[model samples]
Target chain A: MPALKKKITKPPTAARMVEDIIGCKWSLTVLSLVRSGVKRPGAMQRRVEGLTAKVLNERLRKLLRYEIIEREVFAEVPPRVEYRLTEFGNRFGAVIDQITALDEERS
Target chain B: MPALKKKITKPPTAARMVEDIIGCKWSLTVLSLVRSGVKRPGAMQRRVEGLTAKVLNERLRKLLRYEIIEREVFAEVPPRVEYRLTEFGNRFGAVIDQITALDEERS
Candidate 1:
């Protein structure tokens, strides 16, 4: 088994955390889409434009794991499923918006 | 040759651009380190803590390509080299700072 690194005086910094969140392209885009209410998996797949089913599914699972986005499943013939931003996700969305605004300034 | 897709009415959004920057773990962390004074290749390798030499070199090359950071090479026996963020990089850093601040709020 792989040993876990001991926690030192300081844990990983906030900067590093942000780096991880933004490091995965699908996560960033998926989060943005969820914030915009592209709740259905198919709709979200359409909204992000270039992501393949494999990658989108992977990202969604990770987001669910992170609790940034909540996934809901309904009992129906087709099994309706939806995703929405959690409160934590909203805060993250605000930060992403700021980054978008800055990129706009550059353009 | 892969055919270039025609430019649509809307180009890729600013959010998409930010997504690309943050999507790569190395690029995001590299920009953060360069914003600090860890400019030399060896020093940067140490400060980032876990990146291999190959990845660091790759990220540095990409940053240089983006013109977000400028590289300075001194003519000397050991060939001293350094990197500094350009104005564009400084603006990018500000956006990163906001993201970092948001992460802190959550923590």
Candidate 2:
């Protein structure tokens, strides 16, 4: 006789994904800026507007850790730094952009 | 001469909206459940899986406060309670569903 089997199930919804996406305060903002072509960290801060220096730095670090953004350092005087969205991050950005567009259209 | 007016600018992105949507840990979960047609508060708790009674109650209150969900108390024995998504909440739920669909497609 075959052994009785138990089926493992997964949550039908994307609660985990939603949780991961909105876990950070500045994630969406950072993604938006990166999508808008602000690759430099300094410029990202400027584009986000109203984000404090400390918060911006922390968010950038978090984004880097999450692999949502990549950091590249130039081998030059003063070390030019650039941050760009990874493929995954770009996909997330597209979702955010669509949501933002829908939200704006409602206004 | 017209005064050189300062542009009272608004944040170009939806930081506040994102913040508002994810402000509560259970907002997304609750919205998901409501969209799936689990209306009663008790049933909502059951559908979310892993949410505690306390958390579910608190989340329900928060969802009510945010106007994302509506509460209707039926005039009956023992007081029947039901919850439903407002129109705005339905729109938000559609976005969430789309995101969830995308996430699932990636798997």
Candidate 3:
């Protein structure tokens, strides 16, 4: 019984979680945009050719949940919301930078 | 027409290619094992908790296609085959190492 349980149960590893976050093509594009200083939702949609509002929101929510990125809402006449990487997220981005570096190094 | 075509066609970037490779959870596990020096396919199947021979072979073939890992066959009576990372693959591993580092740094 113990052996079966051990075989069946694998913890949600940080690495696995990271992999899940980056696996989606849209997620990778979103993260890349955010990393490259495209912060607001509108700008992100514009920068990347076909990123729609619905999908962008979904990815943003997922990124927020992972603590890889954060959202900030302003108190102006029209509330301007922006997203940016958290401290841990910035560190996470550095790892992703390695992926970007992989292409550069090889090229 | 050119603008429409440009919007519709996004070139396959190297980073995206790398993402597609690591996107497989099993691939990540297999690469982790290979990086840790577990070389043989049979040994790899035994080492991971629930990895089936079929799935492992599928992953191995995919990794080989991406040129991430290579296989070698010995000339002994009982042929011995072992897999190792290529030069490009070792560099790819370094990006993966950054991900492993992310967990360690936070913990």
Candidate 4:
């Protein structure tokens, strides 16, 4: 007889994804910077004080994993990488903007 | 002379509050249960598997701290406590409903 199994891990939902994305203060800050057209990693690192390259890379990877942001590589002698929100991310950003406004109102 | 102090904590914004509230799997589950009419603590605890009284109390306290939910006590032999969403929470709930629909679509 086959052994019975129970799945303990549930797939992350949209809400869960949002929670995960914004749970970190740095991730939230990074998302805002990316939304405001600060695209390159180096630029983002410079823009946010105390944000190290390693941590920024991890945050960027997470954003990419969740389809919140996408990267573009330009063909050049020195390659240029830039980040932008996907369509879904744009929609998510709209919700975030609402939250920002709500924050302004409440705080 | 008084020692110079550096403020280490950021006052939680509305977005931060939402992030904190939904960051925990159990907290998100409890919030949903409360939103769906699971008012009493005992009932909420029974409704969610693996939710203990201690954890439920903690989540409830966090919710009350954020002003997301308010509690009412009734006079009886056994005092009855009920939880309900505040006006701000209702607005927050509208955003939550949007996220629920989004989650249903994405997941």
**For every candidate, how close is chain A to the native chain A in TM-score?**
0.73, 0.65, 0.76, 0.79
lDDT of 3: 0.77
TM-scores of all candidate predictions against the true structure: 0.45, 0.48, 0.54, 0.58
Model 3 over residues A1-107: C-alpha lDDT tens digits? 35554456443445565566656789889988888888899999988888899999999998887778899999988889999988888887776666656656665
lDDT over C-alpha atoms for residue B1 of model 1 = 100
Query: Which whole-number lDDT from 0 to 100 does residue A20 have in model 4?
Result: 67
RMSD from true fold, candidate 1: 9.7
- Pairs that collide in candidate 4 are none
Candidate 3's TM-score = 0.54
Report, for every candidate in turn, its global Cα lDDT versus the true structure. Answer: 0.74, 0.67, 0.77, 0.80
Which stretches of model 1 miss by more than 4 angstroms?
A1-101, A104-107, B1-14, B103-107
RMSD of each: 9.7, 12.0, 9.1, 6.8
lDDT of 4 at A80: 93
Q: How well docked is model 4, in DockQ terms?
A: 0.30
lDDT score, candidate 4: 0.80
State the fraction of real interface contacts model 4 keeps.
0.42
Docking quality of model 3: it rates as incorrect
| lDDT string, candidate 2, B73-94, tens digits | 9999999999988876676666
At residue B43, candidate 1 shows an lDDT of 88
